[model samples]
Target: MGLWDKIKDGLTTDKGEVAEDAQSQADNAAAKAKEAQDKADAAKKDAGQPDAPAAPAPPAPEAPEAPQARPADEHKPKRKPHREYTVVSGDTLSEIGARFGVDWHDIARINDIPNPDLIYPGQVFKIPNK
Candidate 1:
């Protein structure tokens, strides 16, 4: 069978059928993978190419450095994050913005609401963090 047909058959098969012989299935999968790898190596050898090197392990990610101390008076506004807020009855963009310490225009811009004054209940908006 073609690869796609095999994939479709696998997907359409009943779960009970798959669970019947799990160990044998796993062994078959490993054998198939090893056979495919062997075929690829043989093809490369036939083309007069040297055997490919084993893949190297990925480098570990560096740990983040600690933040330096800042002056108490240095009050630079950090870039605020956003949180999703669902609109409720009697809620307006201005009131929502006021409650969240964000500008009404910013709320409208972020959410791409066509009409700033036409928000309905259950509509979700990304409210910027204070």
Candidate 2:
């Protein structure tokens, strides 16, 4: 038999093995994507909390309520710092740094990107200092 025919025959026999491997890889990728999507959905839900409402408009001056004092050293939960920015058109490392009042080197280090020039539009970058 010719080389082409022999190769085709081998491939035909191995097709199942190749298909199984491809399917396994696809399943793994799909699972990972689902996990990432779930995390994103959870974050969105957490960010949309309605428990905290904006402060009411300043009321006219009135008699203050009796102060209910607490311990001077009482510990309260620290608020998580916000640190994310999306890349937009006409955006550069220097420009973003200037806008956020941070150094370009710090931004690059926080993102772990070797090349700042490689960032593209729609890519979200972490604005560190958390």
Q: List model 2 lDDT by residue over 5-93, tens digit each.
A: 98888778567888999999999999997787677667767999443222447879998899989977567766546478999988998
Which of the numbered candidates is closest to the native, going by highest TM-score?
Answer: 2
lDDT tens per residue, model 1, 1-130: 8999999987897878768778778999999987888887899999999876545478899989999999886797656488899999999999999998999999999899889989999999999776
lDDT of all predictions: 0.88, 0.80
lDDT of 2 at 72: 70
Q: Model 1 Cα displacement at 99 (Å)?
A: 0.2
Window of ten residues with lowest summed lDDT in model 2: 49-58
- TM-scores, all candidates, are 0.39, 0.39
